[model samples]
Target chain A: MSTASTGKSLAFTAGDGYHDDPPLVAGNLSFHEVTDLVALHTEKKTPMAWYGAFSIANIGLMILLLSVAYLFWNGVGVWGLNNPVGWGYAIVNFVFWVGIGHAGTLISAILYLFRQKWRTAINRSAEAMTIFAVICALLFPTIHVGRVWAIYWSLPIPNQMEMWPQFKSPLLWDVFAVSVYFTVSLVFWYVGLVPDLATLRDRTPLTKKLRQKVLGFFALGWNGANRHWRNYEKAYLLLAALATPLVLSVHSVVSFDFAVSIIPGWHTTIFPPYFVAGAIFSGFGMVMTLMVIARKVYHMENIITINHLEKMNIIILLTGTMVGFAYITEFFIAWYSGSPYEQYAFINRATGPYAWAYWTMMSCNLLFPQFFWFKKLRRNVAFMFVVSIFVNIGMWFERFVIVVTSLHRDYLPSAWDYYTPTAIDVLTLIGSFGLFFTLFLIFLRFLPMVALAEVKMVMPQSDPHFYEGHGDGHGAAHDLSAGKPESDRGKS
Target chain B: MLKELTRETKATMGIYEPRRDKVYGLLAEFSDPGALLHAAEGVREAGYKHFDTHSPFPVHGMDRAMGLGNSKVGYITLVGGITGLAVATWLQWWTGGVDYPLDISGKPFFAWEPSIPIMFELTILFAALAAVAGMFALNGLPRPYNPLFYSENFSRVTDDAFFLHVAASDGRFDMEKTEQLLRDLGALYVEVIEDLGTEQGPAGDVRGEAVEKAQA
Candidate 1:
């Protein structure tokens, strides 16, 4: 019975060889211990180390707010968005940040659908990343509009002007797409938080009535009723199912902003699939970057194991290959079409003034990910961190090349001009990261950085019938008939 | 958490008094899932319809033990998805075709092709939002208070212990009998759940306890 099909035997015992080697979660944790460990982050006194990071992140948030203020006060013209290159750093940053958010949904929704148990370790933080990344992303379009006050016009709300956003416009589609994606993500994230919030509520000593009240209010009076779980499970499954399509459609619509246009490089049928793949690839890169630091700083190595990192690396490799293939297909299509404008768009991207940026995209996305093929490199935290940074940088340049190159030299040579980001343009891009990291750091400190409820669910100790108390599922890994769980590890 | 909880002794004070409206239910705690699962079956077998099993996370087969039917959240989502599709299609068709018909490039204003993306997104959005709201409604959530909170031992319900609570309002519920049944079924501790007593529920209603029982 090809071991894979006999899930009863191997699933709890041995997994894909990678897991058998070092277990997905170490330091065998019981239902109670896991709760204590995970909840400790939120309930404990603020560590001095946390304050150090928080201060740095606050400075970043301040920079983000100032840059946004500048953009809104001066208008879209404050950036390098001119007549010929109307879509500049702003659009590039918008697409880049949006792409980074996709990995979060993929981990929480798509992985949940596929029943990837490994996701239990990383889903909370990944989802948090997605929320913050989207928050940073929402800023670009608002500032890009020039009239930030009239941003509400982008929505199909009833007003005295009787104005309706043109349904034909992809920009209008983007407004719907991003907003819906954000709302769904927030709901999904919040729903997952309820059970854990209850845990935090329960853990709060009666002495701290204030903390209990605050946490209890949001916990929604959850007593972990079995009936409530039944509904919660079904609701979560439905949301995951709904979010699965959204993860795909949201990026597809974002890709439409370019593909619907007549611009040679932008108008391609392969754009949707290509953008989706690129988004996952880049998003995973950010996940890796954040997770590596998080696991180290939080002493979460027991839960966020090396095996988990390896699985994510494998995905990065797969998506990176798909992206590289998309790049090649774009070149082939440009040449095959025999349209001089398309050919020039492709050729100029490589050999023209922007070749440096083009090569940066290629090396970071295509070349660096190849290193992950080495199991050792992929498992090495330091090496993986550097490589993930490279992937993110390359993904950013990929957008820059696609946006700037296509618009810098349009069909009319007279209108062609070299696009250069003004100081505001550069600062705003940096400020978006400032915004993303600021939100992320706050989430890390205040919220349960790891999914407490989910992590407990994965523990064999949680099963009523299993008495095996080995922290890493080792006891159950031996026999299905193991009865009467003992406290294998002493109470914390 | 690191301060070594000053209220650590909130475990149980023995024979918890049910001070008038303060009583919510009889909460029986089991140290492990095996005991809790068995106790859940006993609670169901005893015909206690308004009882539930609570643990740090969901336990396998606990639903069957609690005798709960499949959740209706999925159906709610389906209806919500259809509503969104209808709304999106109707909104798009009316706005583009009838309300403000501006023929730009001779393409049909209500073309089905371009509308699919919005349709798909809207359907997903509506369905997802419905699922969450429906779940919260079904579970009677956003509730700031539950009498279970008054039992300090119940806090471990989210940590190490597994508990089966039989509400005081259940048709089969008699406090002494249910407590006896639970203790016999391997309960490490049995504590009476008491309310915060911050508000009264229409004279003798016991609002928090009444609402939870009424759902069952």
Candidate 2:
């Protein structure tokens, strides 16, 4: 690779026909240098551990697919859907997957807007995880509706029956919210992929024509021009601005599906914000869980640095605190509302048939993230990974508590019944993990796991003021020119 | 008649020098953008077509200072947004209205309220798509090859250097006079540059031929 300048002069004239030597030393990393780095990460074949993980994911996927087939053939009764507990594992999984998807957009878009440079390495993979997780989430809702074919009816339009979907229903709101969230997230992810796709297109073997064509189509003819870069940046900034509000609104609306209902424990005003915070908290935990393993596997510690992990830890701690506050607020409101039904619901959650789930939720979400408050603990990747897994388990338990605990002890004591997950329910939930991992593995094999262009932009050599070379060959002229007042030097 | 013309015309000539020492000197030398614009206007009115301005960062109104027109990005975004809204609406109607019919939550199949989120998403999606497409269309992306790229020093655009090049194609180009003008305008160094057209076609042709031969 040629690292030295090719001894070419660039002219700048004040008036027509006058030529000037290029003012600054031009330093650029060759295409070969960039490719070498990419090859280092991607050239290696799938590791033994990845194979093991993939096999496990495959098994889980098999179970999930089989269960879905059974459910479709035999109806919702194949799981544990009864009168009092109509929504068991399906709704729980739906919320869980949705929560998992939240952190990707938050890390990529929200952090990007704040100019957090640490996000460059992890954002690509994290966005891929978001898309996959949302795909896993969509499954539950589609199946939970029982008549899977009738799913289109949720969309709003004037039908042949001359009727309109009731706008007041939260489920209808969910149909809108989830679809929008998914579409925007997909666009955001694909747009980010364009530059990296071009990078791949440039480096791939000549024989890989199909790969080139596919990547070329996706790249949409990006050339890294200044004008293209300027607009690319503007569009990205605008998308980030748009996404922040959408992330908040989508989760809040999902929470409304429960909160707007007359169920004593679910019908709280604090549900929306509480759910959003919990979603972010769990989402960050999931990112950490995946990233710790990914960094070790791909040897990307320099790019996905310890500093990035620490930042994520801080967010986890903050959201954990918010979740703890919401839990306390719920209890206080239940007492303050003075309605016997509401009061009973809280007490039942703590001491009822599924008290274990409630306590597990409290400890996992509230207690585990507290460890991150210590700088040492936050920096410990092994410890962080363990805590992240625990947090995920804790969040799943939290949803179980919310859905089952509230519905089990309704206003009418005669109608109250215990909710239990059958074998199919358990298999389906485990299967979702398989689906998530399968998609993630495929992404890992193909995509540029790091944002290479964004990283190059941040390198120190790219700064012209930092380079102390003038057009003249002599060193003293450059220093004497540099002797201009500090404020005037490179002032624009 | 020539003597009378000379008497009537008081020549107020302004000279410009390329300040090679400081890449971003042009930005700081001018007091403000307004002053820069005024200077540009003065030069234009005097029928002196050989001048340029440089800045470390993209200065707002600099295009207008150089007498360039507004870009067409806005128009592209608008058309894209409208198209997106229409497509989203049409897709919803086709799938939910025409293709299948089933009641959800005891409500009519096609609910407009639920469609707002998709509508908003599609609008943004279209706008963003248009923004990037319009940018590429106007600026000509994927060029992969340019005369500027052949000049190794042109990489300074990505770095801290700022520059303005008055092309040789300009009608008033005079090497000695332009150099003197640049020096008068406080340019530290001025040099003439040769255009080198780097050949890159043989590689493309070779690749294409190899593919064809393999297929054969």
lDDT by residue for model 2 (A1-492), tens: 122221122111111112321121112233234334544455466678878888888888898899999989999888877678777999999999998899998988898888776677678888898999999998999999999987777775556766555444678778777877887788888778776676665555557677766766776654343334445566667667667877887788889889989988999999999999999999999999999998788766645767678889999999998998899899999999999999999999988889999899999999989998899899898999999998899889988899999998767789889988999899899989999999998788777776666654433222222222452222112233322222343343
lDDT of 1: 0.80
Candidate 1, after superposition: displacement of residue A383 in Å?
A: 0.2
- Report the C-alpha lDDT of model 1 over A1-492, residue by residue, as the tens digit: 011111122224223323433334465444555676788888788999888877787777788788889777777777887788999988899999999999999999999999888899999999999998888788888888888888998887887887677787888889889989999999999999999888888777657877877787788887777777888999999999999989899889999999999998999999999999999999999999999999988888778877799899999999999999999999999999999999999999999999999999999999999998998888888999999999999999999999999989978889989999998888888778877888888898778888888877765555555544542344345532221222221121
lDDT of model 2 at residue B137? 60
Candidate 2 docking DockQ? 0.09
Q: How well is candidate 1 docked (DockQ)?
A: 0.35
For candidate 2, the TM-score is: 0.72
Worst 10 residues of 2 chain A by lDDT: A8-17
Report residue B43 deviation for candidate 2 (angstroms).
Answer: 18
Model 2 sits at an interface RMSD, in angstroms, of 10.5
In angstroms, the error of model 2 at A177 is 1.4
